[model samples]
Target: MTSPHDAWLAEAVDAARECAHDESPASLEGAATRLRIHASLERRRGSSKRRLTVISAIVASMFGSTAFAYFTGWRPFAPATEPARPTAAPAIEHEAPPRARTGPGPSVPVEPPPLAPAAPPGEPAPPVLAAPPAAAPPRATVGPPARRPRVLPEPAVRAAAPLSPATTPAPGPDAELAAYQQAHDAHFKGGDPAAALAAWDRYLAQYPSGELAPEARYDRALVLVKLARWSEARAALAPFASAPVGAYRQREAARILAAIRDR
Candidate 1:
């Protein structure tokens, strides 16, 4: 049995025994406990690092989101802007006051010249007389005592006899007739109807029953017709119409009256 393989196995067994004899159980247990403690400490340190990274990521995400929202017009925490203050106006230049106007100065007083002395009284004045003229011769004067005899007025010539009632002249039919004819001619032939009518009316008022009265009335009616006085024309014709022997113009009056009534 003292072969080479056998010797090597024995040497290995002897070294193991020597190593087992040198190490203590207490030391081995102590080393194992230290290794467990180191492993646990390393695991705790790794976990703490991972938790810190996760927290940092969450904080960065929130900050990015807030910045994005702020750029998109969200201003939840923005302070209010103040109104701008107005600029003050510049001061204006002032003009000096105008001088007061002064009129002319006071005038100096002047004294008047002295008056002359008064004259003394009591000097006597000279007297004056007028001369008389020579006389002329007297002539014979015709005085009232040398008067001539006078004849008396012939018994105060008795006032011409007072006109008696019988002597008083009366308006005659001939005068009325002449006046009516004159008025008629004036109205018809002379072209003076107003004067003619006046004269006719006077004649009618003075001698209503004269021979020419019918002619006067007829002419007056014609004058009225010419004047466009229908009513007065009708009135003027009335007297002629009632007469038994109507005047020459009565027939004409009747014809005109008929024409007016028809109208």
Candidate 2:
């Protein structure tokens, strides 16, 4: 069965494969050299398949991730965006501020100069007539309350006799008088009991025996009674009840003291 031609060809092919650098050798049955070449080719093909499998697997993973995101509504973190602001409304064109009145301003109230003290009666009365108050500039408002006429009704006889020190009221319009007045005003006009309390305390501290001290003490007692500080009220009323410090309102103080005692 072994032919010489086939044997010779196989021998040539083996020689070429061993002697040549190129791998394109002729195929032959029962060729020992072909075994090594085939084994090398098989290894290259296996490596290529493995590389393709890895690349396919990577691609499939990326696709799967994309699909999951699309289905699940997952998105990359995006900072919250601010809603667009509405366009500003056109600026209202306000009339420019009224220019300062160019012409002479409204007539300044002309208060007539203060009149001297009225003379005593009987002697020819000096003219008290003030020119009809110059019609008070007809303000676009009610005319100011009638002002005291600058001219006086003729003064009673000569200037009033100078008041003696004893009969004259405590020469005031000073701080002490002002403080006492503020306290009194607080008691009646401010309508705040606590303010009245503070005012009286301040006034008394500065003026324990001032001319208005008795009146101040009496008013303070009344305020204390109103505030339900009956203990202090009773104490304050004690001097008045007992007539100490030239106390006044003894009848009222005594009755109030009796009421307190009964209570």
Candidate 3:
């Protein structure tokens, strides 16, 4: 149950909001002023118990109501409007105009031929002919069909991707060391002369002239002697024990050879 004053205030607020859209500066200013007053009144509404505040809010409300009404076209004191001027003939009537056509000033609109009168009662009505279906528009070729992407031949790709078809070369120093270390471990640490022999053979096959080949050859001969493969031992030891190139394990190789020959 809102009071009449609340309803009037609501209408004033609505009128102010409507006036906010007016293109005129005066209406916009009046809307802004009324809105500010409304905001102040809302803020002091709960404080209506204070006499001074209520008096001021009421005065502001009166001013806002007058403003809202005046801006919203509620004018009891508006000046009488003057009579409107008569519409004059067009300016072209005063001047000689250029000829529109060689013959006529303006063409009259043609009326459609009157439809045939309805058939007399009980006679059959004429059949209406329908327009034919429109032809489908031709499909335009936007351009030549998009060229299919060229697929790479698998064989050609394989050929291009691979490096030159050169044979794998000999093992590197690190690989040589790794192979020799494996044989050495099998021989000394595991005490398996047969496994050592296989590892040595693998190392020698891959790295015949590798960095550790001299050492590997000497060790392999000892390993063959341990295995009692006399012929292979003789063949293996003879190369290093006889010449003892670089004196690498020379004494060891010679001692092993003499012992094997004695055996």
Candidate 4:
């Protein structure tokens, strides 16, 4: 079955392929040889670079350790013997501050001028006027009770209640005083002057020298005015009007007395 021409063509093709393979510079053996040469050059170069890096690292580490030791005073090159400390420079003697003149100072001590003799003793001192009595009042009297106004006086000086022996024992002075206030409100606020007057009289009888005595006496005088007892009212108000000048009751008593006199 083989043709002669086909066999010749096939042979020619095979020969061409063999010639191309032999002429190519990149054969497997040549490629291997190049790779080996490049690898050796890289090895040589890498070793030199590694040596340079190690030297640089050694230099850096030495420098850092030297700096650390120097700063920490661990390896300082200070001398063993101590250096002499310089002394302070001797002070030059400048001329003493110019002295104040040796003569007397600016101001001389002097005795105060003699005081003028006190004015010759004045004529014998005049006698001093006697002081007025502390509780003195101007002489005055109450007018007729019939002429008095119908209106009742204020309770400023009204009397407190009578403290009866029959009363229960109170816890303290406050309770006792409250009881007295209750009685006062009963008679005084009830609008009965007569009953109020009687209640006040009983209170005064029980506590003649009580804390409310002055007030009771004053209220009694007012009640007397209501009952047309002008003389009794004047007598009752007399003591209060004569109270010391600056006493709390003095001004009020004086005022009431004056009103009575005007009436």
Candidate 5:
């Protein structure tokens, strides 16, 4: 009986021997070529793996750098943040109380002055008198009854001739002449123009053909002007335009009429 361990070792050695014996030159050569190809493939696989590892490391580094930059607030093109503004302090509040003044104030009392004294009653104040000058001498007078005149004998005188009828005083005042004179006095001498005009009208009616007719008409026109009756004034002046130049108021009427026409 063989021991168990020796038997297993022997079997492993037999298998090794058998495998060597079955190998041939051609097979070895084929095996060497296959091994070389396998080795080249394995080298390629190693190179590929190394390259993948390098790429993975680069990608991981990029991701880590980006994450770190995001968390750290590092940005190449981003705008900078403004500093925070300081907050204003709250305002303090206060309450005001009414004030009370001390001590008494001054007083103002106004009083008027007394009136002047009154004069004494009755007993009229003595007249303020000027001093008298010396008295004048008395004038002398003579009595008129001392001298007498010699008397002459009286002679009877023939009666005075009877007064002629022509020489007798005129019977009455000339009515027409008196009226014209009154009108003239009222219109020219007196300042009352309305009364003057009324008197002139009466004179004209009583003595239309009197010598003073033209003069009366002219004065009437003047009064009419004062009365502001321009039309009637012009009518009064119309007759004088054809009157003789020597007429009393012809020239005056013409002048007044021309003035009226111009107006």
Candidate 6:
């Protein structure tokens, strides 16, 4: 048989061995579970940090873009100013003057009589009575329609008056004789036979009873003879030849007559 101390030591030793086996498995399982938990927590923390960094960068980029846009005059949220509208100037209108009242100064507007109600169909309408012609305006003093004033002739325009002195004497015999002598000079001195004939004829017609009348006949007969007018020369010289025997041109007229008859 063994002692009691030896038996107690064996029991204690068995108990200690059993406790070590159970504690080692439990500690190992607890440590492995703690490592798995710690790994999951670390993965979650890393994802959260990356997401926060990305979010912060995106926010910073958006703020920078907005500030750049504001500085460069490219603002996205600034209110715009509308252009000013031009105001129109008021118009000045001038009113015209009222016209003069013609046609008898707006006579009392006579209201027409009201019409009767319509008669049955097919009945002839009654004729409207005409107004009297308003007394013909008092005949207007009519007065011969205003005779156009007569245009009397002016005193200066009537028969013209003589322009010379009333008392001027008539031309004398000597003056008349001088005119005849001047005409006679035109015949011989001017050497124009037709002009000489015209001069002699004028003297004879104007002064048939003058002292130069016979001389005018004598010279006119001579001019007719020079022009080959034999019949006129004969007729002209006949009167002078038959004149009184002592007449101024009687002998010359007879000589001219004889010369014409010879031709």
Assess every candidate by TM-score: 0.34, 0.33, 0.35, 0.31, 0.32, 0.34
Tens-place lDDT digits, model 4, residues 240-263: 888899875778778878878755
lDDT of each: 0.69, 0.80, 0.77, 0.68, 0.76, 0.75
Which ten residues in a row are the worst by lDDT in model 6?
135-144
**Residue 52 C-alpha lDDT in model 1:** 94
Once superposed on the true structure, which residue ranges of model 6 sit more than 4 Å away at CA?
1-170, 244-246
Write out the backbone clash pairs for model 3. Answer: none
Off by over 4 Å in 5: 1-173, 244-248
Tell me the tens digit of each residue's lDDT in model 5 across 1-263. Answer: 98544655575566556558768777556656655665676678779989999999999999999999999998789778998999999988776775444334333343444443554786466545454554444433433456668778789898999999879554234877788889889988999989999999998887688777777878898999888788988898888866899776778788888888855
Candidate 6 residue-wise lDDT, 1-263, digit = tens:
86544554565566556656767877657655655665676678779989999999999999999899888978458678998998988988988986544344334456666677787889987876766454433222323356789998877747676768867666679877976887789778988888888888777777788877767777788888988999999998898788899786788888878877967
lDDT per residue, candidate 3, 125-171, as tens digits? 88655555555555443443578999987764334455556956556
Better of 1 and 2 by lDDT: 2
Q: Which candidate is the best by TM-score?
A: 3
Candidate 6, clashing residue pairs?
none
**Candidate 4 TM-score over all chains jointly:** 0.31
Instruction: Estimate the overall C-alpha local distance difference test score of candidate 5.
Output: 0.76
Model 3 score (lDDT):
0.77
Model 2 per-residue lDDT at 260: 85
Q: Assess candidate 2 and give its lDDT.
A: 0.80
What residue pairs clash in candidate 5, if any at all?
A: none
